[model samples]
Target: MLQVKHLLADKGNRIYSVAPDEPVLAAIRTMADHTIGALLVMRGEELVGIVSERDYARKVILKGRSSSDTPVQDIMTSPVISVNPADTVDTCMRLCTDSRVRHLPVVENGKVVGVVSIGDLVKAVISEQGAEIEHLQRYIAG
Candidate 1:
């Protein structure tokens, strides 16, 4: 069973965040600069919410709101669905499916450690399956 800690270890625990009061445009720019789909909205060391490209599209563009004037808190998804370091990859996948979210922040000891996307979980699953198949093939060869 692959855990989130293992994934974070491979990916590195680097977190990019935006302040809640920052303009949505700034947040979008940050995402663009990082080439990431989402950013964690933080208030100091506390994780408050998450803002993504989808949020910008639906909440800002579709709503005809000005991104420069609109704050990230206005568009960010709050009451975030987060995962623990010990959580299994399957658990994160299920949470993403059930919550209809693409990203999950990894929290341990009340601290945000890293973020994982659906793509990450899928990749991990594929790698795990490949390793399993290789092991089975080796067993059969012996």
Candidate 2:
């Protein structure tokens, strides 16, 4: 099974984050700048929460709140569901499905290393399946 470490190795451990006190608009800008769906809410290297486009939509837009006036912490999802580097892709998938979250922060030794989205898990699974199919085809042809 593919592990979170393997996915991080392939995708690179690049963490995009926003300060908890920052305005939601700033967090949205960061996400837009990176072309990502979510941003880790950090407070001086500590992961406090996570803010995604969905959060903005539900907490700010739908509520008729001003993104520029609202702090990211106000809309950010807290007590985030995270995964360890050693965790399998299958485990990550289960967590995402059960939690109804799209992003999972990868932690190791009590430190944040990276973040993986549901899209990443799906891509890894598809790649693994393709490799397995190729291997089985070669074995059958031999």
Candidate 3:
């Protein structure tokens, strides 16, 4: 079984984050600039929550909260569910589907190591399948 560690090994380790007191608009701008859907909300060096586009649409826009005035802590999802590098692709898929979240922070030893998206899991699975297909073809040719 392919584990998240394998995928992270290829993707590299970078935990993109924003401070909890930061304005929601700032998070939005970061997301836009980085082309990411979510930002991990941090309290200093520690993770506090997660903020996503959904939070902006539902909490800020729908609720009439000003993105420029509202802090990320006001709109973030707290106690965010995270994954570990040891988690398999199947586990990550289940977490994503069950939690209804696209992005997951990879934590190990109480420190954030990387982040994974549903797209990343899908890509890893596809690569695994391709390798298996190549192996089967080679066996047939032999």
The best candidate in terms of TM-score: 2
Candidate 3 local lDDT, 45-82, one digit each (tens): 68789999999999999998899999999999999999
Task: For candidate 1, give the lDDT.
Answer: 0.97
Please provide, for model 2 over 25-85, each residue's C-alpha lDDT reduced to its tens digit, 9 standing for 90 to 100.
9999989999999999999888999999999999999999999999999999999899999
Candidate 3: regions farther than 4 A off: none
Score candidate 1 by TM-score against the native: 0.97
Give the poorly placed runs of model 1, Cα more than 4 Å off: none
Clash number for each model: 0, 0, 0
Tens-place lDDT per residue, model 1, 1-142, is 9999999999988899999999999999999999999999999999999999999999999999999999999999998999999999999999999999999999999999999999999999999999999999999999
- List the global CA lDDT of all models: 0.97, 0.96, 0.92
- Model 1, position 13, has a per-residue lDDT of 88
Q: Lowest summed lDDT over 10 consecutive residues: which window, candidate 3?
A: 41-50
Q: What is the lDDT of residue 67 in candidate 2?
A: 93
Candidate 1: Cα lDDT at 78: 96
TM-score of each model, paired residue for residue: 0.97, 0.98, 0.94
What TM-score does prediction 2 earn? 0.98
